[model samples]
Target chain A: MTDVRVIEIKKSVFADNNEDAARLRSELKGRGTYLLNLMSSPGSGKTTTLIQLINRIKDKIKVAVMEADIDSDVDAIKIKDATGIESIQLHTGGMCHLDAEMTRQGLDNVSLDGTDLVILENVGNLVCPAEFDTGAVRNAMILSVPEGHDKPLKYPLMFSVCDLVIVNKIDVMPYFDFDLDKCSEYVHMRNPKARIIPICAKTGEGVDAVADWLLEEVYNWKH
Target chain B: MHELGIVFYIIRDVKQAAQENGVEHVNAVVMNIGEVSTIVPEYLTDCWRWAADKEEMLKGCELKINIIPAVTTCGDCGREYETVKYGKTCPHCNSANTWLLKGNEVEIKEIEV
Candidate 1:
């Protein structure tokens, strides 16, 4: 029998990705580009909300978008056609989430010149995407009315990591059993500092607050 | 699906380690998966068997998992408890201000050659 040797290598698998995220954040800061990572479940109206917010802030701030999905460029094409801005599609090659390196590659494909903000629509996954940081200046998620208000308790990590939680489909809240007050309370239970904004993306109700929040964030990031 | 991505990361790290140590043909790779890390061991091993075999050096290599139990510490009560059982609340003091002390790790422990 041949002699067997053991090589010790105790290190977190997320360490490299975390380091890369930090480096990418600093680089984006130097370039005066604010990156926002938007995450949610599939069919959470991410595209509609983006279209609403982008139309409000595009003239004031040079905005671009990176839509990440496992396959298809439908989201990218939709955003470009609706908002008429620079938008690119990133296929994760069957991966459920986008890591820092993937976010960097997507940024490279977009022209960052004269661009103040780049919003990355991450893969529609609450679990895997929260585990990997995409080097975004801030992380936000949209929770629709039909998904129920107890999601914060179910997915604590996703709620805790996000800086903002957009409660979309408020128009249908009366039809569904989603309680806005209870939802806010649960969200606070996970993260006290998280800002919750309720809006109906289809009717453009309460969308100005989201636009204002993004504008303020982009301004603060640049200055 | 998530485990497959993690398996790729493990393969990359192992390959780099082998290159640095001037070694070839890793026999087994050991991983420390925490209880609350959201990784299923069976899926991870399945992905490992599929992906690792595709690599020349890691072909026929075994992926061994060591599960670490999750523990949480309460800030109000100043006590530790099982994370999976009590979750974010401290069972001792019934305080919601508890944080995870351990068991969120997804680390590579070692490699046998």
Candidate 2:
């Protein structure tokens, strides 16, 4: 005779991810490697901003880029071709977002020794990416002017959890009906502690400020 | 979009639990899904149905989702309200000093055998 019984197991789906994230955070902290998880909507100029930032600070700090996408290595190719920096392409196998375990696996695949700053462009998503903590020291998000000012209201959790919010495409601000002040206001309403920086990736405008902020954080993470 | 991946995780965990408890087959898996979570419940079940059937223990197993309402608390007024309605600003006191109290969960609450 076959035995049948009811088993009650109460466990969180994210519990494993959270535990892995904490361990990764401690490991990165001990290694003095600062991980920045950058997120944004598609075509928000994340790659351009990363290229510009890498070009500006490559001489001072050791930088590595991890390009995560559902498929394709196009972003990784662009990063290597544009800046000649050490870059790794992580394919999530059709997953829209990368969790902590996935981040740890990607880190293991790459070389982080003597790497001061490791930037992960997290799947170019505003929703799923924000929901999972990837053991990053800082969560940075970009909101392009073309994406409009009401995005914070529409996607509150994404703006709320980010430590830094960058408003890109300021050079075309005149073309688009994007109000920088209004957008900043909405972001502040959602997360009062989030720092907002306005920049244009194509013109290389206001990128220095971002580099400066990053340098400060990396220095702090090390010391 | 990543619902299929999540289903994989669920299958792995459930299989482990069933093995530990000497369960031959799982009847149902109840998940606690928060209202504001990024996971779409319908997509999750669809993925579960397809993926769960592949495993021997989880074949014909049901996936039940319990949607939890999102709530926000006003820092100034000490009042709780629906997060989906008013967002960060508190409608009671009109204060922006509000924070989410709950409703970001993606957890497995129960497993039936």
Q: How does chain A of every candidate compare to the true chain A by TM-score?
A: 0.98, 0.95
Clash pairs, candidate 2, are: none
Ten consecutive residues with minimal summed lDDT in candidate 1 chain A?
A172-181
Q: How well is candidate 1 docked (DockQ)?
A: 0.86
Q: What's the CA error at residue B65 for candidate 2, in Å?
A: 1.6
Q: Residues B1-50, candidate 1: write the lDDT tens digits.
A: 59998998999999999888998899999999999999999999999999
Query: Per-residue alpha-carbon lDDT of model 2 for A103-134, expressed as tens digits?
Result: 99899877899999999999987888876789
The complex in candidate 2 yields a DockQ of 0.68
Candidate 2 residue lDDT tens string, B18-92: 899888889999998889887899999999999999999999999999999999999899999998888778999
Give the range where candidate 1 chain B is weakest over 10 consecutive residues by summed lDDT: B85-94
lDDT of each: 0.95, 0.90
